[model samples]
Every structure is written in structure tokens, then in C-alpha cells.
Target: MTKKVLYRIATLLGLIAILFVSTASTWYIYQGDTPEELL
Candidate 1:
């Protein structure tokens, strides 16, 4: 594959990973009983 294609794939993977992490963290935070528990 070309360098440009590889770079795009890497960037897309990074974005997907970040999105997954944020979504998981948000789910966990909301699952807590109180807002204070988030701290």
C-alpha cells in the first residue's frame, strides 16, 4: 500500500480508538450512583 493510504488508515484507527475510550468512560461514569463518585 501507498504511504498516504497507510497514514489514513492509522489516523482512522486512532480516531476510532479515542472514540471507543470516551464512550466507554462516559458509560461508566453515568452508571455510577452519584456524580460525586465520578471524582
Candidate 2:
């Protein structure tokens, strides 16, 4: 693939990861747990 395509894919993956982490943290907070407990 071209460099542009690869970069786009990487950017998309990063955004998805950020969204997933945020959602997980929110869920943890809702459950009365600190995110640190996930470690």
C-alpha cells in the first residue's frame, strides 16, 4: 500500500483505541472502580 493509505489506517486505529479506552474508563467509574485497579 501507499504511504498515505498506511498513515490513514494508523490514524484510524489510534482513534479507535482512544475511544475504546475512554469508554472502558467510564464504565469502570460507573462501577465505582479506579482505573488503576485495571493494572
By lDDT, who's the top model here? Answer: 1
Q: What's the lDDT for residue 22 in model 2?
A: 100
lDDT of 2 by residue, 1-39 (tens): 699999999999999999999999888779864578667
**Mind sharing the TM-score for model 1?**
0.77
Supply candidate 2's per-residue lDDT for 34: 54
Model 2 clashing residue pairs (backbone): none
Task: Kindly give the stretch of ten consecutive residues in candidate 1 with the minimal lDDT sum.
Answer: 30-39
| Cα lDDT for residue 13, candidate 2 | 100
Q: Which stretches of candidate 1 lie over 4 Å from their true place?
A: 34-39
Query: TM-score of every model?
Result: 0.77, 0.75
